[model samples]
Target: MKAETVRTTLTIPRELLEATDKAVLEGKAKSRNDFVVQALRRELAAQKREEIDAALAEMASDPDYQAEVLKLEVEFATAQWEALQLGETPK
Candidate 1:
């Protein structure tokens, strides 16, 4: 299936355009358009990941979640200390 694409004009720095063309000639990209599209896709994906990470950080900072995490940490430390006292390595 062919994806519909729109023609657009963007004013980019001359050096950047030159680099893009170089990439195409070096076979790093099929063409300048492909290089730009791939760059945009990567940037968009990175933005999405940042959004998800922010949401997760907010959720983790919730009072209830923080309390549970603290409880688990204490339990883990106690278990590790007990294992050491018993001369057993806690793997």
Candidate 2:
């Protein structure tokens, strides 16, 4: 499936543009547009991962959430033991 795209202009530095052209020539990417799109996608994914990590850290520090996690761990311990008894790896 094709994604919708917006056309725009960028003013990349000379050295970077040279490198980008080299990469495209070497088939690292199909074109400057594809290179830019891939780079932007990677950066956006990293940013989202950072946001998720921060949210998880906040949740880990919350007393109620921590207690609930511990409660679930305790609840699952018996299940893990049963799996071990059945010769499974207990995950």
Candidate 3:
């Protein structure tokens, strides 16, 4: 994989930082940076999923919007299935 490096700073609670360091020493992560990155990624993915589901639910509550969204969902599903058959990952 191609990679690039960047420098950034974060302000975190002292307790949180100490806990993260402990986790690193316990072998939960290669370093404090790795732990924070993995945690942020997981949190972001969960938040996005929650937002999508909330939007779908709101749309479903409206009869007309529900129909349109259902149609789009079907189309998306079909495309995902086709991509899977072609050995591509669908996101």
Candidate ranking under TM-score, highest first, comes to 2, 1, 3
**Candidates sorted by lDDT, descending order?**
2, 1, 3
The TM-scores of all predictions, comma-separated, are 0.69, 0.82, 0.68
lDDT of each: 0.94, 0.94, 0.91
For residues 58-80, could you state the per-residue lDDT of candidate 1 as single tens digits? 98889998899889998799888
Per-residue CA lDDT of candidate 3, range 9-89, in tens? Answer: 999999999999999999999999999988999999999999999998887798999788788998799888887788865
Candidate 1 global TM-score: 0.69
Better of 1 and 2 by lDDT: 2
Q: How far is 65's C-alpha from truth in model 3 (Å)?
A: 3.1
Instruction: Give candidate 1's whole-model lDDT.
Output: 0.94
lDDT of 2 by residue, 1-91 (tens): 9999898999989999999999999999999999999999999999999999999999989999999999999999999899778895564
Best by lDDT: 2
What value does the lDDT take at residue 67 in candidate 3?
Answer: 88
lDDT of 2: 0.94
Candidate 3 overall lDDT versus native: 0.91
